[model samples]
Target: MFFKPYMRSLAVAASLAVLAGCSSTGGTQDGSMDGTGAAGGVGTGTAGSGQVSGTGMGGNGAGQMASTGIPDVRTIYFDYDSDTIRSEFESVVNAHASYLAGNPNARVILQGHTDERGTREYNLALGERRAGAVQRYLSLRGVSPSQVEVVSYGEERPAVRGSNEDSFAQNRRVVFAY
Candidate 1:
């Protein structure tokens, strides 16, 4: 009886732990499936049928790619279904801002993306929001508005392919194309 009670206690503890972990964040493990816009409908559903090219910006098109090449910082990853830029990408965006400040004529393109989870339309809007977040970050840092343009490819193009969290994380990102 003692051993039986102990086992029961252990099982309950384990179950509680599992539930707690999942509840820390809102929505299901698959954000897009929750139907709550908290995740912005960007979830890693599966490989999308639309296989558009995913050429994230690495350098500005005006020979910047050939001249300056790509800096060490090129890609910024975001949380599932979120357009808020993470603090980790602050340095990269600041560097881009500094570069733009120095090169008045240089232009940059911000390409936003989302994992294949939500509806295509939702993902497209989410992608645009992500790009706009980056644009705002750069603009706040003294980068000229004329130097920036934003595009949203949505989930049509993925940096990585898969429905799993790891792949989804890779696909949810903004490319800093100069």
Candidate 2:
């Protein structure tokens, strides 16, 4: 239950070193936390030009048009302890569904997340349910089940780091990763 005075100082130094190591910027071509570029698509470009040129969809398929259209909104938030899609996000889901249906070659991963509140197992199941809800919605809209995958990170990854209502609301959601 207690540490020697020297041991306490050593632990503090180690913690500070780890924190310092974590503070460096990422190496992504685009300034996103994820290494996948701005559009999350396979693209080619010269360095420092601020332009990407290539075939296929770009970063998570955002701004890339399919037969139906492009889906700019790739994330939809959820309420506490619920897997139901909110009314406001219906259109967003619809757009993504249409895009997938229109482009058979396109594939997407639905990542489900939840706020930190429940037990680990409970949170993981809740995340899966949230993602499955979106997958079902897409299927009903004419998207093939084969083109979509679902993953549950639960409370492992938080969009905003905090223990507040705003942070919780932001964390509970499904993201369409192309």
Candidate 3:
């Protein structure tokens, strides 16, 4: 009986932690989703060459697959339904942030995306949050706010087409277009 109360308290704390982990900064309390008029394209490419091919957000047709001096790790991926950046991508992002800091004229577009599972609105919001997380990380590392542009394609543009976990893993990512 002595340990029962402590176990109960522990259980409550764990439940709260799980709830907090699943909370998102997207959508209204009424379940209505809002869209941001951000612009960007979708696609994936070889990391070594740093080439991305896709239509520009507004039909610019400027998207091409070529290494334009971008770093090898241009894409930062996130886990399922979470906007937090994974630990493995931290150094890569930091490298990009450092490069941005060194070159004020260098501009990058952070295209946020998500897998096809959640509601369109939720995915979009999650994408935005993921991109925002990277933006905040860059800012923390001394990158200027003006140097980065954020856009969320959500589930509309996927890197891979499939319902399997592999495709979903590839789909959930933030690509840096320079």
Best candidate (score: TM-score): 1
Distance from true position, residue 19, model 1, in Å? 31
TM-score of each: 0.63, 0.62, 0.62
lDDT at 64, model 2? 37
Model 3, 27-110: lDDT tens per residue?
111111112221232112111121122221212112212224456668866554445444345556767876788788999999
- lDDT-based ranking, best first? 2, 1, 3
Q: For candidate 2, report its TM-score.
A: 0.62
**Model 2 C-alpha lDDT per residue in residues 1-178, reported as the tens digit of each score:** 1111122222222222221222222111211112223243222211112222222122233323444655767887764444545434555676788889989989999999987765767678768867887887788778999999999988898887876555666887789999
RMSD of each: 15.6, 19.1, 16.6
Q: How close is candidate 1 to the true structure, as a TM-score?
A: 0.63
**Quality of model 2 by C-alpha lDDT:** 0.59
Model 3 TM-score is: 0.62
Global lDDT of model 1: 0.58
- Model 1, span 63-93: residue lDDT tens: 2322243445678766554554443444556
Residue 67 local lDDT, model 1: 24
